[model samples]
Target: MSDNSSLLRVSNASLLPPLVDWTPPTFTPAAQARVAATMVLFVFAAISNLALLISVSRGRGRRLASHLRPLILSLASADLMMTFVVMPLDMVWNVTVQWYAGDGLCKLLCFLKLFAMQTSAFILVVISLDRHHAILRPLDSLNAHRRNRRMLLTAWILSALIASPQLFIFRTVKAESEDFTQCVTHGSFHERWQETAYNMFHFVTLYVIPLLVMSCCYTCILIEINRQLHKSQEGESLRRSGTDMIPKARMKTLKMTVIIVMSFVVCWTPYYLLGIWYWFQPDMVKVTPEYIHHLLFVFGNLNTCCDPVIYGLFTPSFRADLARCCRCRPPADSPRSLDRLSARHESDPPKAT
Candidate 1:
């Protein structure tokens, strides 16, 4: 009886769990699969963006650099940085289930992610506004190059200003149950308005304001295009082309803008919605952590892949550029092709839409 009692005590001690503040959550197979798939998508998105850049460079290098406009280059450059810097860090965090880059790097990477996102949002705003100027306000088209440069500069500056707060807001924390750390952002006052301030700021500046600007710009652009088309037709009712040429050309431009704007709304709205939903700490409700993380990346990364598709579909020249880069055409240096390309560029340098 005494020996049996001692054995029971020993078994109880062995079964006891470790004392720790927090334990890493069990990684289920489904979650693991979802992360792997997300990373795979990111990799492909990066590849596609790179392909776009390469095609732009190659086509232009073989032809003229004028085709590689500052706006497209800036947008693509941001996406490329995300692919290399932000996305890889996110993948590492997801896979390892921790933030292993230490505290300093944690701050830098966090800042960069926010900055990259802001840059993307504002770049779209500039693009939409530029599209308006390019089409409806054709008088400004002459200064398009200078305007693009200024906007690109402003976009990065604004993004940096917005992202600066991350340094103060994010920090590294270690799990007591596991030898792992994570970098997370919290309000200055952990249990107070700090969270609300941060959350609302991100939602407003990154999502809401940009949405409004782009929406208004595109709306004005469409209206002006329609108005101008009618005006031209009314005046050219008896002309030989009968206003057919101008309307057709303008419609083509409008169609491209529509695709670009619509794709932005569709691909990006979900990510921002998800971001705001994350902060809905209600009176008697809670949100699941796993659900947000799993889908956040999937939604955000969709925009990266969508850009190239939009370009390929709406920009006929980009498709031709890509094909030429892919070797679907004969050597660009062939005297005949060279002469043709030179004539095309000379007549009208391919405007970066």
Candidate 2:
């Protein structure tokens, strides 16, 4: 989310056992700005992610490659989780400036927040890997469905497992002296380094590892593409086919996904970098303008809003679906008629390419 927990730590230093003596953070202008920006992003993300999921499951999406459909569907599903879980949680937490939901919800919401974020990153990695396979090993496309399924299953399970520690680490700690309560990992660790270590672990897993994997996958894809281009240049027949090594559909998909990954990196890198700095040097928080962190967080949330836009830009089917929805236009033919037409078309003689 917006790292409310980190903000809580900033306000309350020297964590003690049951009750940490500290002042509660107020809903300052910075927090207000974050909440406002988050509300805008949330509305866009909710509508767009839902539209993408629907488009992927029905109509033209049904005609998408069997292997690719799952990847896109999984990506949209993860973005939806971020939409519903992280956006609302960050907005509400910023507004209230304290935990009113008590301990049970405190733990559960924290877990869900991490789970959503981790799931989103993991799914992107899966998509990158899928693109790699599609480009590098075209013949293995037959087994792609099975391979993608296994990878998706692993991504989900790994996300849950990585985020499981949140349940034990977070709780509602009341600052009796200030007569305020906040949900944080204040008393979870015995030493300061332990808390830093925990945060760094999540930071690496959530950002660093996924970024590296996506970069490597794309790099290899680019090198392979260049090699194919060179080979095509050497052969007159290859020139006639126009880089037939990679199919147009597959290349288009790869470009769309690369942009998506770029969006992720561009949006989240600043927020995470600030977080890393604060984790290592808590003193920096005092000198840093509070609005900087809040702005960075809003920038990070932009990634959720970007995915569907990128997909629509690449896929004509998605744009057509949106246009159809806006115009309230129904298909000229019913589903049964469409099916019969499709069958009749299939029975006709093949046309020359």
| Candidate of highest TM-score | 2
**Lowest-lDDT window of 10 residues in candidate 1?**
1-10
State the C-alpha lDDT per candidate. 0.59, 0.79
Shift of residue 267 alpha carbon in model 1, Å: 1.7
Q: lDDT tens digits, residues 51-135, model 1?
A: 7677555553233223225656676787777677666765665566566778899788888877887787788887777666655
Give the distance in Å from residue 335's predicted Cα in candidate 1 to where it truly belongs. 17
Q: 100 in model 2: Cα distance from truth in Å?
A: 0.6
Question: Model 2 — TM-score against the truth?
Answer: 0.89
> What's the CA error at residue 175 for candidate 1, in Å?
3.6
lDDT of 1: 0.59
Candidate 2 Cα errors over 4 Å, as ranges: 1-21, 328-353
